[model samples]
Target: MPTASGSRARGASDEEPLRPAFDGPLARRPAALVARLRQRAVPSHWSSWSGVVSFGCLLVLVVTGLLLALLYDPSGALVRYGGSYSLLRGVEMSRAFASTLHLSFDVSGGLLLRQAHHWAALVLPASLILQLATTFFTGAFRRPRQWSWVLLVGVLGLALVSGWSGYALPDDTLSGTGLRIVQGVTLGLPLVGTGLSWLLFGGELPGTVIPRLYVLHLAAPVLLVLLVVARARSALRHGPVQFPGPGRTEDDVVGFPAWPTAAVRAAGLLVSTVGLLVLMGATLVVSPVWRYGPSSPGHAFAGSQPDWYTAFLDGALRLVPPGWEVVWLGRTWTLAVLVPLAVIGTSSLVLASYPFLESRVTGDRRDHRLLDRPRDVPTRTALGVAGVTVYVVLWAAGSADLVATQFRVSFEGVIWTLRAALLVGPLVAGLVTRQVCATLRAADRDRVDHGVESGRILRSPDGGYEEPRDALGAAQRWTLTRAAAPAARPSPPGSGADARRG
Candidate 1:
């Protein structure tokens, strides 16, 4: 393990040297672009496809979002419906709500694009999450790529905010309820709560929230594009991480060229993703705003929920005990809102700082290009499993009422059970997952060391039949051995000064 200075000194050895393929004239030349891009190589792995798919989803969202924006009106003015949908033909509603209805039923192919846009939005966060999980489990955030992880975390945060704000754009009863929840949550902060709420709504609940949220939803993509570009530049500088395999070196990546083959393949993936979104949009219904009607404080829908990405917060709120508020020094404090906010904020901080934290804890500062198998990093893998379990559990808790009703159980009992699960689930998951990883690693080691039975019957001197065993081939043995191998230790600096302690 090396200190920060030592890591910096050896940085050049850690990353593959890459040419600036798109600089100067090549970047501006449309004719030679395809050929030039094809010269850059990417890792030939299924995980690499995740980035391509995510980018495709981004394009789908942008195109569909632009179309939807053309017909959207973000005003709070109430208007009688004059378009299709006979049920609400003359019902009065806000212009924002009415515009969504018009887009859904009146405009040609409008509903398809709108629904596709939504489904793509949902897929965007999910894909980013998958990519992040892959990066984390593989320890791809080490050394030169640390900042790249930060940029990715930023992108994911913005995507969540964008999704939440976009989900609130329709101004239906469900959306309005979500907005109210946001307002209350914001207002529960200690000192800045009131001012934050004022800025968010521009006055009070149902005030300028719609127009403000519309701007935020639109602005998120522009920021996302910028951050993604930054992340790409950083990644190129560090080169793509590769898996350990035969004839593979730490100095370079082994994969296909990015231009002709990868570009065409990525394009095909994009087209397929868009086509699937279209199929889902046309054949399935989602977010039926017409059925929910326009936003009204007095009219509460029987069941309401935010999009799946934001449901964890809803779950946290539901799990909080009633009468959890506190009053001190002439001020009221609401733990119901504060607890969820704290959990989310703390979790974000931990995730954003994870790379540096791992480096400090492990005392290893060497640059790495080969990804570690999850089973080889038991502690980190277990932590990842535990975190994911908590997230899924919280998401389920968001629908506690439904669970209670469906199972014919006491709602209070369900809430209490969830609270208990929240406290105990992660500990169990972490320990169990760590043991599982250790066991799997031991099995892999055994397979590599002792080999497998070839199932051939052999007659011994005692007339006993036995199956013959075959050792793993050189390639298979090398692969498993390299995968199970520990990360290389950094050489001590001059004088062996215990730089880490210093």
Candidate 2:
């Protein structure tokens, strides 16, 4: 054996090994090299699963929308030959409604395509509203996301415009009737009615109006997208809002990975598509066409119902006192135009200012991880429902003619009843809802301090009563005993979180 000095000199391969460093056997590789790397990527939290479903539905809308555009003639074109004065005259004409008729019966899959487009137009708005309700109920609109909530409400307006416009594209008897209603409402504006009508149609009543609407129907959605993009940009500048959950920490939140969430969303989209297809097919029952045949001025479609989203407008139009016309600048103006725009628009604007205005109203700075039970914040939420009720009443009144005749009442009576309900019902409901919420909230507060209410009322021989238990419910018990305060507005803008937002 070599001496100690010699062994040190040998140095266990201070020299190179026989094999290259990377040439080690595959089995010698550590398994974690692959596994560990996979574990650490973007933790896959996919927020907005419902929004993803909505986007998927929008995808279908875009495809169907394009087809409708191709089929529709936006020229306000009309068919005329040999001085035939009839609306359907001229065996061959190049007008827009004529083209729609051609598409309805002529195009292969055209009818199916039309039905799909119509169904989607209906479904998207309905879905968006439902999703908003979910967000509202969950109190997902609170804190860091308050502006996002406002943008969401605005999105509903966009959807309403888009749905209404898109629905008008077909210009079928039903749609034509709806268009006539729009013309009537727009023309009903005070002072500038005729000029406004001319500006919109480039002519008088019913001439090329469908084409003009087509232009608007097309433009509105585009404008909506731009607006949504702007609002979303503003939201991103701030940040997305998070919900209260186990995964969330004092400073942050956690959720299932993206892969799982995306998979779930995709699956939901698939189901929606299938369901829509079935709906479109089932709706093949012949649509009644003559009800709203080509514009007949003043002869309102005998039975008219506006699309759900625009129902409120119809309701508003119905409610204004018959003599509600106002005189301004020596010209006659109607509440029909100013009222809907003022009430709906102003209300939306005010609500949109909630993030900022509320902060000013209340001074709260601490980050809130919990949601307020709507009852705890009764006034605002109740007002929200009341606002919606008012809208429903208006939409119901839009069909005053039908309702009056159907029930053997004067159209005027129908309008007044709905108008009364519009003003009173929601407020009453709001108060009742608020009281119920407060009562429930108090009960919940009791449970946290005490245990479940056992409802075992014990009576002594003296007939005095004592209860053994105090309880609430799962939903009630889960909320914080003291409701989180609403956000307050700040004096000026700053880097840190502030309630002030528009």
Write down the RMSD of all candidates, one decimal each.
9.7, 10.0
lDDT of 1 by residue, 1-502 (tens): 5455224554556665575867677565874766555556677677767887778778888999888999999988888988879988898889999999889988999889888888988989999999999999989999979999999999999999889989989999998888888888888888999899989898887888889999999899999989999998998778778777654556645666776666787788878987888898898888889889889877766657678888888998989887799998898888888888889889989999999999999998888887888888899999999899889889988899889888999999999999988899999999999999989989888887779889888999999998877998766677687776545423212221111100
Candidate 1 deviant stretches above 4 angstroms: 1-39, 459-461, 486-502
lDDT of each: 0.83, 0.61
Candidate 1 scores a C-alpha RMSD against the true structure in Å of 9.7
Ten residues in a row with the worst lDDT in model 1?
A: 493-502
Best by lDDT: 1
- Which candidate tops TM-score? 1
